[model samples]
Target: MRRPHPASRPAPQLRIKPPRQLIAESGADLEGHGLRRTMGLFQLVCFGVGAIVGTGIFVGLSDSVAKAGPAVVLSFALAAVTCVFTAFSFAELGGAIPVSGSSYSFAYATLGERTAFLVGWCLLLEYGVSVSAVAVGWSQYLNELLNSLVGWQLPDALSAGPGDGGVVNLPAVVVILLAATLLVRGVRESARATAAMAVLKIGILLLFLAIAFTAFQAGHLSPFATHGAGGVTAGASLAFFSYIGFDAITTAGEEVKNPRKNVPIAIMICIGLVTLLYCAVAVAAIGGLGADAVGDKPAALSLIVNQVTDSTVGGGVIAFGAVVAIASVVLAVMYGQTRILMSMSRDGLVPRVFERVSPKTATPAVNTWIVALVFAVPAAFASLDAVVNLTTIGTLAVMAVVNVAVVALRRSEPELKRSFRVPLYPASPILGVGFCLYLMYGTGWATWLQFAAFLVVGSLVYACYGRSRSRLVAPAAPGA
Candidate 1:
């Protein structure tokens, strides 16, 4: 066979498709989905809260407190402000696109297939490690709850992962499987379960607040900014972890009822609820327990509850709540992972099996199970410390891209209907991207290198498979 000239060779799939094409595909293909759009504002808000309120408040507060002392409360405010700019960008994009895949979908419609592939790849790391990390946190609290309530605890061999001197973190795997099973059942049931858990979780935090304030001494907050402005910004960077779940709302657009209007509503509602809850919890814990005492504690919230009440029962209840709260995180993270894969697969970026939704459950059965198994290994055997940092990087990067997507779509498709438009035109998204980049810089260069390596691998995969199989062909198929 004669060798083809370089110019004669078919170019890779890099051309951007018209936004209308993607919109039309959605209109036609979505009608055939097993995915029912039954998720309302409350369920959406619950999903965001369920995902947001747990990991940071329970375990991450210790590190934040150590960095910024009582000023960690201000740290939450700083993070929230950063989140607000990004949230506006998300609201605008989610309202206009009203599709799945989150930034990946939005980026595809605006930035081109290559950039979307990279965004989806980043999300894989973010969601997978996040689920595993939440599972690990749940296991720790579950063990604490057992010891606190029943005066019994699991052996290190069964309770701790290898990173902490154990054969396997069996509890982590169990929790991941449980969350996956719930997700496989369907979104409505999952949302309802999430709402119930959110209520219980909020109740526990409220109880802690009430108890903490009884013993609150202004003296505890003396010398509040121990480490100064640098420390506060560092704490904000770390505290930003809790805000990742608001983006989880963007992933549920297709399943949300009235997504164009409701997605933005849910995003803002979730942001407000999360910011308030986080600030309250941080202040209460620090006010009652003192920053020095709580700074190094692993189960810091429970310890604060114990110190305030001077009873194991009080601590035990808090521990029980921590378990439920982290369980919700596991559920939301796993749910986000499966949905992103479904979106990518539908675009022919992954195996088609991923996009297959179960008619019986109206969920992506195989995708959910696969996501559970993938994260369960890490939860059971690996140290998630390094992997967890990658989620922060991935999240910041994706949020920046989503902001840019809003700008690009505005310029490219001016006539397109947008239920929510970002205020202040280019400035909002520009500021959103700028803030995200600032945070990404704080995540350290090591994480940046890892993110770059991740994109390199994803690009290789795209060249080998995604470009060849991508459904952006003539005579567009449903959701192509």
Candidate 2:
């Protein structure tokens, strides 16, 4: 056969990491690249709960209520339904792949290196911005707790960001730094601390529910759909932030024992537990105090508790719980951010510095510190509402990509070992993608523009750095 001219030949296809190769590399004991597997089912579940049950319920609930009124309960339900679909996709992929990169790794195996890089980039926004948003919420609750205990609170100028009439949010920065410190010490220690805090915070929320229910009034639920379907959809977009952490369980795939089995189980359990608590809390808060009263109030849960019981003690307890709850979120989500970067670094998609694991701590010390410092700047100066919306949109986009990836993998790797599978296969993953898109649509156009800008920057980074340096990319000819 005649040789084809180089100019006439088709261009090379996008690089892909074989699923089998990814599996083997994940299992190999590569020096300086290994993450210790210390988490069991209980620890993993705790990590998920720690990440899931925080600012969204304690602080952001008011925002959702403002948009949807008493029907914010329906908003929570809508968001939970979206999450359930995505969670099914995540569970199937996490079990099949069992890698720390989460959706990014799944994309690399099924889609292509370029698609995987974008997914990873989107995750950076999802996780890093989420930490900042959660930290800001923590500051609000911290201020509430301080007032309850000492009859004093931080000035608005000190406790809030520039967009919220504050020059800087000092407490937000402090909490993020504290979480970074714990992460640097080690993952096992962090998981134990998170588990304890997770249990305590759950008890505290239950207490709020118990006390608030005593004052429940059916009349408060009148005119539930204040803003109608549009409001509920918008509220659902914001409420989606509450469920961000369930997939954080998947990000710990490399650090969990029997990951293929444990990761999926933890995810399902976490989602069910979190959704139930969130819906119940929403009902209790709205029932105790009308939606108009709760909407837009800082530390709204604490205020509701105080009003319902005519005492500051209940409010103080809830404030303290919010502080602990939001702190755990910062810790757990930041951990996920560092792990995702570590996986990208290993694939030569990001700088090698991020891949460094401390010998003494078995943690990505440098990566953790860098992420904390970078994200803390936003926590200090950026508006909470802006970051929350941005994070939600980015997360939804990433989840949509994961849903598509699951379908792609099934088609391409039919015989691959999977510890768990999406119940409805094609239909389930298809619905997952549709739900993610629907929620993303509910976000404001400003966020879409911001996301577009982010993707542009990411494309440039991959073009100039990641694409050339990626491990799967073949080297150029010496004299080409």
Best by TM-score: 2
Please provide, for model 2 over 34-120, each residue's C-alpha lDDT reduced to its tens digit, 9 standing for 90 to 100. 688888899999999999999999999999999999999899999998899899999999999888888889899999998999999
Please provide TM-scores, in order, for all candidate models, with all chains considered together: 0.94, 0.96
Q: List the residue pairs that clash in candidate 2.
A: none
lDDT for each candidate structure: 0.85, 0.90
> After superposing candidate 1, which stretches have Cα over 4 Å from the reference?
1-14, 28-32, 474-480
Worst 10 residues of 2 by lDDT: 25-34
Q: Candidate 1 clashing pairs?
A: none
Best prediction by lDDT:
2
Instruction: State each candidate's clash count.
Output: 0, 0
lDDT of 2: 0.90
